[model samples]
Target: MFKMKSKSTLLLMLLGAVVGSLGVTSASAEKARIVNTGKHVDNLIHKVDIRNLSYFDTRFDYSSKPYKMSQNRYQTYKLKRSLKIANMNKHKEVILPKGSVVTGLNDGKGNITYISNPSLSLKNQKLVFKTLGNWHGSLPIIKNNGGAQQPYTRNTAFSYKSSAMLPFLSVKSNKPFYDAEGLSLPFVSISADSQLIYHTKGSKYKPTRYAKIKKFKLTHSAITYYLAKPVKGVATKKVRSGKTHLYRATFKMGHVFQMMFADNDTDGYSLTVNNGRQEFFISLYQLGWKYVGSIVGLTGADAVSPTDAKIATDYVQGLY
Candidate 1:
């Protein structure tokens, strides 16, 4: 009976040890699964290293070359004394630090001094200065014997001419004049008494050689002339014989006018008219009739007239 009881106790002890081992193995498996899942989620959502990206290709190349000492006649130097007692009577040799710049040197021996302008980091245990030209780590001294030249006087009388008609016509005129093309005709003239009188240049019976068929004026700006009408007749016809029409009527500032094309597509044109203002631009656009689309404003330096603006737009669209 005693032997059987001892046998039963030993069996129970062995079973407990086996159960504990299996529990430890299950816990380890669970911990490993959690660790692997965390790593996979981090890799899927987070950026590991930005520097490893393919877009970054530029790198700084550190040079390993030594600095050269200046050989100027009036350069500064430091003395190197002899350590041996027998060589104490000999003259001490002068030495200069690496990358020492000789700015202003004196002739006397006691006044010798060296100036070093080194960067934040040193190279080869020596002072390193910023350099230009080749990256071979050589600093070449350049001397300018000739002093700075005197500034040339500018011509104050010279004035820039704008390509716009308004800028050209706004200048003070001594007398009434006509444009070379005869398209710009002075319709009305004011005398010293401020009385308005009809101009003979655009008269129906006695028209000028290049008489304009239509004229445009700023309605809100006290009747200031803007641009002449565009010609529509055949290209072979003469200037006087070609038919001209007013494409844009007299409208106020910021008023857009639509021009219909043969393909049913239309373009818009508007003038930003302002009194006593030297700067102005014409806005053009490609859109449907009565619908304002994307507009591009052309400056006076670009186009001065409706015809010029149309030609510019056509050229940009590769129509030319």
Candidate 2:
């Protein structure tokens, strides 16, 4: 009997040992899973957000009206040798494309004169020529109306100019000119050697009058801005002190954001944040000095990783 009792106690001790071992194994597995999940979250948070910088201020105000992001106006044009001359006698009027440049005109005579000044008209398509000399017959007018001979064919050889005109006196003043009204104008070139001044005109007017003989000193003070190098990865963290918090908000994954700033009085810059699939835009007076925000497109309720949020928040704050 004493031996049997001792054996029973031994059996119970072995069973307890086995149960304890199983419990330890299960707990270890659960702990390991939690650790791995934490690591994954950290990785997602650190992932970089792609950034594209632009010199144009692409932010718009939509407080009173529904906001719509502007579509890209960039076009691809194929270069062609010659364009069809418009036959005015057929009562056929050809309007040039908005951005087309007229380098030369068919003087309504047989001769095509390669003149220095070119006119670019944005609104009208009719190519009308003020006769320089009576040919006694209708001349062959080169149709500069913005028709693509073939799809995407653009003749850039002609000096193309913007339709918006700047006052001749303002350009000659040699002082920095700002289109306070945000008007787009053609590039103006003043001759350093002669009093000849040339500007771009549209096909609506005569080509010869495009060039002007005016006296003005050459000034190299014209100001322009170019796009800065794009930044990759998330924004760094830096806190700024101001009355308004520029970029303090929760954003979901795939949300897009843009920050626009004026580097100087004459130049502007834009920073775009492409998060997941959604895009958002923000236009600021100075980096973070003053700003207005808008939605670039539709967004959803997907939560973004903490790291991405931090990176984006820190980047905008760093700019300030």
Candidate 3:
């Protein structure tokens, strides 16, 4: 009886060992699969045109080869940080948790007017789309130096309003990076009560360059504003025929964007007008990466400040 029991015990132990081995192998395979997925995505990045992709969405920030870039906004644009909301009307303002999938309901120019979550909305049957972002412009510092294998390149967001619009691409940094000298970089914010009124609805430079305003809208302090009809036209060198019309959106405020395509050249704007009340022309020249020069507000040139001129003149940096 003792010998028979020992034989049975031996058989059972051998079976258990085999089963454990199989389980271990299965776990190893799953880990290998995950690793391969990261590699597969990283490999595809090398073969595509980077410009067509939104900077934060597709582009990787790598300074060397054997690029390690998979955890970017490659899949979807998610909130890196939580945005708080205190809705006075609905009494249902909740902090949007990190990693909320941002749905598309924008001004077609990356200006997210609102984000809708029906589950979060109550009382009002309509899905209350609290604004996902207010364009707070930014200034970023690149880790640039000689002898570095890969110096950081220009990768700013397409929109002028950024949490950082440096180089006008979508890259975010919570804290300013320090140079080799350990000096903290400075930040620039042209935040002002500014406005811009221009139209890009006309896709052609036809017999008469005209666009009935419809594409863009400005939201300031929870109040949205649209461009009124053009009351009069003005002459400017920015346009070829000098037929810049002042579409009626009076902005004593600062810079605001007029929408454009990814590869379209900037359109011109007439001076800021107030139905013959006030006329000011502001012009800004983007000399280079971090240099914006001049703000001329006059009768025929429409701009409130230097930042307004910079944004109104060159809002489409083409990073989208």
Candidate 4:
């Protein structure tokens, strides 16, 4: 997405995903669309209404180790030694005592944990600064200090629902495209939703003008994805390769639920759990949006346990 003009700009980050991340993949310049079109191929769809109470069942505890939980959404974790901390929102750094107990919620992107300090007078004062990368790999939040903003905050802490979501929906659209040589191309596409996803390399795209987008449907579950209205997406920039239909949408469950798309990127509809902040990008002439809508749809915008990740993965994998 060309430094989207709105929300300041939704800087695009290709997930380098599982099935569909904002990451890029290599492929022949040739472009083509599958003969079959419409209704997203039902054969690839494994139907199980996410609405079923069964889907929420943490059916499998993938971990043998004990994981802590909170009376609410916040879970418990311990620091073996004193750890340096900062408040992303306030830019004030603090140090937690050795053996400091932190309580909070996470969605992988913005894993915010805080020590209940009796000394701190302000309620918001307890906010702890922890980036996804610091805790693990290149996990991400929003732009500089956007802080952890929970969407369900207005009512009972984002409903204790968030995402470690996306993917699982699968990219099943038959994108008809032509390379500079005017050749039809085939790339890796993963079917996560209504029966399919089609891709040759499992990433990125260089788009033709939005000359004509055949009418197709965005299938996959976004069940109560915010427990309400789907986050409205923003049509970002119009790139040089003839307008990569770049767009973004966000809602909070407990964590940030941000979804990005580049009809030109073939990365399909990938996502990232941030601090309810949106800023990502896909290089020009690379990536594609196969339109996977919402996969596991969790975003764990407050991604806490691998448990949430597992549940989403299992359901998408048809285990649910």
- Output the number of the TM-score-best candidate: 4
**What are the TM-scores, per candidate, against the unseen true structure?**
0.16, 0.20, 0.17, 0.24
Per-residue lDDT tens digits of candidate 4, residues 20-129? Answer: 11221232332423221123322222243222211221222234354322211122334344455543243445555443333333343434333222111112122331
lDDT value, candidate 4, whole model? 0.24
- Per-residue lDDT of 1-320 in model 2, one digit per residue for the tens? 01112322442353221000001111111111000113332233223221111112122222325432221111122213433333324354333333333322222222332211212231221133332221111222453523323223331211112111111110111111111111111122211111112222112122222222211111121111111111121111222325422211111222121211222121111222222232222212221112211111112322333433343335443422
lDDT of 1: 0.21
Decide which is better by TM-score, 2 or 3.
2
Which parts of model 1 are misplaced by more than 4 Å? Answer: 1-254, 267-292, 295-320
Of the candidates numbered 1 and 2, which has the greater lDDT value? 2
Task: Quote the positional error of residue 165 for candidate 1 in Å.
Answer: 4.2
> By TM-score, how accurate is candidate 1?
0.16
Residue ranges of candidate 3 with Cα displaced over 4 Å: 1-65, 68-126, 129-320
lDDT, candidates in the order shown: 0.21, 0.22, 0.22, 0.24
Position 286, candidate 2: lDDT: 24
Pairwise TM-score winner, candidates 2 and 4: 4
**What's the ranking of the predictions by TM-score, best on top?**
4, 2, 3, 1
Q: Higher TM-score: candidate 1 or 2?
A: 2
Q: Where is the poorest 10-residue window by lDDT in model 4?
A: 282-291
Q: With candidate 2 superimposed using the best TM-score fit, by how many Å does residue 169's alpha carbon deviate from the native?
A: 13
Model 3, position 162: C-alpha lDDT score? 21
